[model samples]
Target: MPETLNVQTRDDFGKGAARRIRAEHQIPAVLYGHGMDPLHLTLPGHETALAARNSNALLELVLPGGDSHLALIKEIQRHPLRRTLTHLDLIAVRRGEKVQVDIPVILVGEPTAPAIAVVDAQTLTIEVDALKVPESIEVDVEEKEEGYQLFAGDVKLPAGAELVTEAELLVVAVQLPRVDAELEAAIEENEAAGAELGADAEDSEGESTEESADEE
Candidate 1:
């Protein structure tokens, strides 16, 4: 089900207007798609933030005049320092229609012991029904051994969903963690230097004892 947010149309423009809107705890947004004129609007900051937690969240925008539109979040701009939502660009969508979206790829379960699972691609592009879009796609890596690989085409998708990403793209790989060669060499060099220092200290002590005995 799509999360519904009551939105208000806005005529204000420019940076000053945007700042004022945000000051009032609202987010400025623009909605455009399907041959319709772009609509400038303001959304509730708190509700929108919660709804946007899901990258591919579908939203139902209800206008004050009792009109509603289904929209997909196309772009979100955030403050670089504060990480607050600065602006949003939404695209209108319809139910039963196919839309292309980048869905997150999640790995489930652990790989075989001593092996680590590495993700090559974080998300995959797919075409699926607008209303039936999934939050994320899961790839099972349970008991996968070292050298095991998973490609884009190997990922399972919901019914009616088609992959838009290249089939040969690497999604996940299982491998054994190995130490860097330079680090290993540095460790050996440090051990050798410490051993040489110990030998020199022992020789100095023996010479001091011989000199003391000669003086006595």
Candidate 2:
């Protein structure tokens, strides 16, 4: 079920207005989709933030006049340093309607001994019901041996969901971790070069002292 939020229409515009709205513990947002004209709205900051925790959260926005619309978070802008919500762009959606979204990929269980599972793709694009979008899609790596590769097509998606990503796209790879011998050798060579330079500097200083004594 979609989270319900009471929202208000706003006529204010520009950065100044947005800041003022945020100062009042509200979020500024715009809703656009389905060929409708864009609607400027103000949403409660705390409620919207909680719902946004799930990237593909479906929200039912209630207007002051009792009209409501279902919306999907299309984009979010945040403060770079503070990580606070700055603004939002929403797209109107309907329940049961299919929407293309990027769902986070989660790896579950461990691979075979000496083999580690590495995620090649962080998210998978899928077409799923807007109201039924999942929080994440889990990929099983249990007992996977080294050199095992899982592609997007191998992923099992939620019921009725369709994969939009290329089937051949790599999602996870199980491999044995090994150190680079060439890199290690280069580091050792550099250390040896520094030690030789130090010895040459010390010998040069000793000769200078001996010459000073001879002059005496």
Candidate 3:
């Protein structure tokens, strides 16, 4: 079920008006789509904040005149320092319609012992029912060996969902844990330095031999 919040229509505009709205503990929002004129509105700050926590929050907007509309949060503007909401951009949506959204991908279970699972992509773009958008998707890596990799298309989607991201996009890679990751790096640097020194020494020795041979 979708979250429901009562919102009041607004005629107020501009930064000054928005500041006034925020002072009154409300969020200035714009509701737009489906060929209708944009609806400027104010939503109670507390409720809006809680509902906006989820990326794909499906809100049933209860208007003052007893009409309601289903909307999805498209964008949220926030106060840069304090992290308070400044404005919201909501897009009207219809039930059963497919919408493209980025859903979080979570790793589940442990990969093969001593191997770390590195997630390359944190979220995946998918087309899912507007009303049934997922909160997150899980990828199980239990017993997966080192060198195992998972790509975007390897993810299992909820019913009626379709992948929007490229199929070849890497999602995760399982690799042997570098308990000595730093140590191994240091070793490689030292080996490279040693090789350079050895090469220079050989060149010097060759020059000395050539000088002696020329003198002879």
Candidate 4:
């Protein structure tokens, strides 16, 4: 679980103002929801970046009136080349309130045999208390035999957690190797073809040389 990040609101907006905010080591962010007006804000750039490094980060917004609000980091815009945070959107939340969010999926364990784990679903959307949202779910695939397909229903969630995703959805599948055998066969065929071509070239050169010698 990640700790709450502290943020302060900003009054400025737009492209040029956002650029200046970044140069001042603060990130531009917007907070909306609860049927209220959107509040523009600026967060400490370094702390914001570090907190977002982890998935499903919980943020604490400290408003000007000494009031603190809990929020979830919704969307983040970044510079394409520099990879710096350009803007962010935050959604306010209340404690013990269930919020819909997508948590990351982590695979664990190795499947026996040459099998591929096909992940049909990468994230699981669930309702959890705003203060207790999980960052990710760990899927144990260790020593699983081939042809073992794990579904969303098969995931073992942590305590106090509920699944909001459809149980029938395929989360992962350990199937028989799909490409190794074919790739090896193709390589062998290519090598055989090259050998035959080399032999043919040598034979052609020998015949030409013999013909020239006889003419001489």
Candidate 5:
């Protein structure tokens, strides 16, 4: 679901103007798309920040003049030190239209014993309905054995969703746990050999002393 909120339109521009907007606890934004000129906007910081948590947040933007538009939060720039939003970008969209979005990919269930599921792709690109974007896509790995794999094209998409990623791209990799036990074993064997060498050296010295005494 999407969120609906009223926002103030901004006529002011430039660095100083942007700084002033931030001082008021608002985020300066530019709305683009649908072949129209970009509109400058000032959004409430608290509400915008909350909505920005969702990567594909659909915004129902209401302007001061009572005009409204359906937009997607395209991009967000954050302040490095404060970790707050400095600017935002919005792209206008219409209902029933297809929009390209990168949705999070999640791995569910455990693979068979000695095998682990590793997600190679964090987010997957797909074209889905603008109004009905899915939260995330899940990949199942239960009872999967080593060498199991899931490619981007093989993933099941939501209804009406089309994969935009390369078909041959690997999405998940299931393989046996990588371990190195030979090195440790080799070190232990070397230590045992060293101990035997030391014992033999000590015994040789004792025998030499005994031979010297016997000659004396």
Candidate 6:
């Protein structure tokens, strides 16, 4: 699900130091695991960004005093206006350890009919062995007909992963798309008619102004 990462400890904190760290292409983060004191660290910005591109990425951290730890991304903060990472929080995990994480649901295959695939849920939370979390959950809908509905229970789970989501959670459904298309066409036609009416009103006003000038 995730890749390995190596990080170093940071001695500084607060705004000014964070700005300097970001300027140096490093991300400020806090690492906590096994009930140990939180360690403030700075990670290589490019590597961290690449690792975080995946969902529920697992990280292998090499800390100070020659200590090494395993963890997973728990939270991330981004710049409000810029495309930079601001802060990160990581939770410690062990190999084969079970942890709860959200995995994205991916739609696979296509329906035979003109049915629109509706994704009722984008992500599902599950209890998975730390290293066993799937990058994504794939649902094959190939050759499926319209009016087919899929629920959370319908999703195939990988080994050692248990669904923490509610059974009633709707995963996806296939339905006809004609109704939406018809509504969009109607709206476009009405807009065109309104534009034509507005042009006619303007022309009439111009004609009246010309007649008044001629009489004068």
Q: Write the per-residue lDDT of candidate 4 for residues 1-216, one digit (tens) a residue.
A: 335556667676788998899999999999887887998888889999988876578888776677877788899888999998888888887777888889889888777767767677999988788888887899988888787888888789877788899999899888888688899999999999999999999999999999999999
Quote model 5's TM-score.
Answer: 0.79
Cα lDDT for residue 58, model 6?
87
Q: Which stretches of candidate 6 lie over 4 Å from their true place?
A: 182-185, 188-216
Better of 4 and 6 by TM-score: 4
Q: How does candidate 2 fare on TM-score?
A: 0.90
> lDDT for every model?
0.95, 0.95, 0.93, 0.84, 0.92, 0.87
Q: Which portions of model 2 miss their true places by more than 4 Å?
A: 178-190, 209-216
TM-score of each: 0.86, 0.90, 0.81, 0.84, 0.79, 0.82
lDDT of 3 at 101: 88
Q: Write the per-residue lDDT of candidate 6 for residues 1-216, one digit (tens) a residue.
A: 456567789888899999999999999999897888998988889999988877488888876567877878889899989857888899989876899999999998888767778788999999988987778999888877899999998798998789999988999988888788899999999999999999999999999999999999
The per-candidate count of clashes, in order, stands at: 0, 0, 0, 5, 0, 0
Off by over 4 Å in 1: 179-186, 189-216
**Candidate 3: tens digits of C-alpha lDDT, residues 1-216:** 789999999897999999999999999999999998999999999999999998789999999999999999999999999998899999999988889989999999999888989999999999999999998989999999999999999899899999999999999999987768889999999999999999999999999999999999
What is candidate 5's CA lDDT for residue 158?
96
Per-residue lDDT of model 2, residues 63-164, tens digit only: 999999999998999989988898999999987789999999999999998888999999999999998899999999999999999999999999999999
Which is the winner by lDDT between candidate 2 and candidate 5? 2
On TM-score, the leading prediction is 2
Pairs with backbone N, CA or C atoms under 3 Å apart (clashes), candidate 5:
none
Question: Residue 15 of candidate 1: its Cα lDDT?
Answer: 100
Cα lDDT tens digits for candidate 1, 129-154: 99988999999999999999999998
By TM-score, rank the candidates, best first.
Answer: 2, 1, 4, 6, 3, 5
What tens-digit string does per-residue lDDT give for candidate 5 at 158-211? 999999999899999998765546677888999999999999999999999999
Question: Candidate 1: worst 10 consecutive residues by lDDT?
Answer: 175-184
User: Over 4 Å off in model 3, which ranges?
Assistant: 177-180, 183-216
Off by over 4 Å in 4: 1-4, 113-118, 176-179, 199-216
